[model samples]
Target: MQVWLDSLLALLSLPQYGLTTLFVVAFVSATLLPMGSEPALFGLLKLNPEMFWPAVLVATAGNTLGGALSWWMGYGAHKMADKYAHSSHHLRALAWLERMGPKACLLSWLPLVGDPLCAVAGWLRLSFWPCVLYMAIGKFGRYVVMTVALLYIWPDS
Candidate 1:
């Protein structure tokens, strides 16, 4: 099992598969899951410096899509909550989200709260298109800044 996993990792590290693997990692990382796509992206960039923009674009797209999926999940969860549970705290959070609107999605690039912020935006029934636009911008900035900073800090890495 370990050997198979190692082989798969090795295959994914290859230039032909690196961008796809980075996309998957970025997508998953943008969800509620506790994962980081930076290392995968950094590794790919270190291996193929020429693919910087492609990798950044791919990561941003995957991460934005993942955030949209989180938004959908939050929409469904909000519907369920509306049907059943309605605590003061929940109402307060919903109110906050409503007040903030899609502009709040600018924080979707944060480490822990980022993905959940996308969900909360949906939970508040905020405008979907605006939220997506903000998410894309924030996520794109994050990918570009983070990848470039990492490369600058450790060029050989």
Candidate 2:
């Protein structure tokens, strides 16, 4: 069992696949999809201990770009809101988004609602630079803290 686990871990640890997987996972996770990027970071770190910072940065970039994409989608979907007005959830979502403003983008690192939050920000035509800044901050902080915490608890990680 130990050997099998180690082998599996070793495979996931490789720099190429691990890093690519991190970007892919982080990107998808930042899109309204119920996904996570932490496991990818942990997996890569476990394999290539020296790649800690690189992995974090890569994940952040990928996630940030994904958030940007969601923002564009929202910007484009503005006209479609009326088409889906029958859905109470969509109405509430738009209303809540209107109430929060761009600052709500600070929580863009969160799951489920985070991606959609970014889209709404764009749809509302909030200040672009500020939203992007907040998104990057939130996303980067998340990766940094999670990675550091995981490594601290498990040095071998």
Candidate 3:
């Protein structure tokens, strides 16, 4: 497993593959999958500090697109969610989401709940463009802050 991981990392670290690898990882991590893109971002930046901005931008774009995909998924799953609509917990959560509207997508950068929040917004049929805009803004901020913090903490690397 360690050898395979090292080989994969080596392939991704190549000059031609670095940004693309980061984008793919960031996109997938934004889904319901239990993975984090931070390590990939940090590793790429550590190896090529000059590519920081590009990496962040690519990651942000990929993550935002992934969030959008989740939104569509939620939109399509609305019927399935309907069965639980009358539950107390579901009602309260729905009320909160309805009150917040598309603005709730700003919280889409949060861990665990972030990606699902996008899906909920879609399930509730909130305005798509606005949610996407908020998602992009939040995700961009997260990538920038996280990457900067990580770089600061491991400057020698």
Candidate 4:
């Protein structure tokens, strides 16, 4: 097990597979897990400057997919919590979500609240396709902005 784990880590660290690694990192980071994909993205771009746009796009795709997964999880959780659907807090939260609508997903790129926002969007049963579309746009913008800033600040040194 230790050997396999080490090998997997080594493979993920390889610059030759940087984009794939970036995708995985971005996906996992977008989940409820406590992780960040920015470092992985920055490292990959530093090693392979030619793949800037591709890397950003891949990261955006992966992260957006992860957000969708979170949305599904929230949907599932909501289903399981049907018993509490009538609670005051639950009703209040649901009302707030209804007010926000799918546009709330535009904030899905934010760090802390981002992932949970996706889940909440799902929990509220907001329109899935619109939420996903907003998530993709936000995630793509985030990747592009962060990658560009990192490249500018660090250069190719």
Each candidate's lDDT (Cα)? 0.87, 0.85, 0.91, 0.87
Candidate numbers sorted by TM-score from highest down: 3, 1, 4, 2
- Which runs of model 2 end up more than 4 angstroms from their true locations? 1-12, 83-100, 154-157
| Tens-place lDDT digits, model 1, residues 1-157 | 9999988878887878998899999999988999988889888888788999999999999899999989888887876666534688777766777788898898899999899989888777788999999999999999899888888875765
Q: Per-candidate TM vs. native? A: 0.86, 0.79, 0.92, 0.82
Candidate 3 lowest-lDDT run of ten: 148-157
In model 4, what are the clashing residue pairs, if there are any? none
TM-score pick, better of 3 and 4: 3
Per-residue lDDT of candidate 4, residues 45-140 (tens digit) = 776778888888889999999999999998888877789988998788678778989888988999998999899898888999999999999999
Best by lDDT: 3
Cα error, residue 84 of model 4, in Å, equals 7.4
**What is the total number of backbone clashes in candidate 3?**
0
- lDDT tens readout by residue for model 3, 1-157: 9999999988888758999999999999988888888888999988888999999999999999999999999999999987898899889988999999999999999999999999999999999999999999999999999889889965665
Predicted structure with the largest TM-score when compared to the true one: 3
- TM-score of the candidate numbered 2? 0.79
Give each prediction's root-mean-square deviation over alpha carbons: 2.5, 3.5, 1.7, 3.7
- Candidate 2 whole-model C-alpha lDDT, 0 to 1: 0.85
lDDT of 3 at 94: 88
Q: Decide which is better by lDDT, 1 or 2.
A: 1
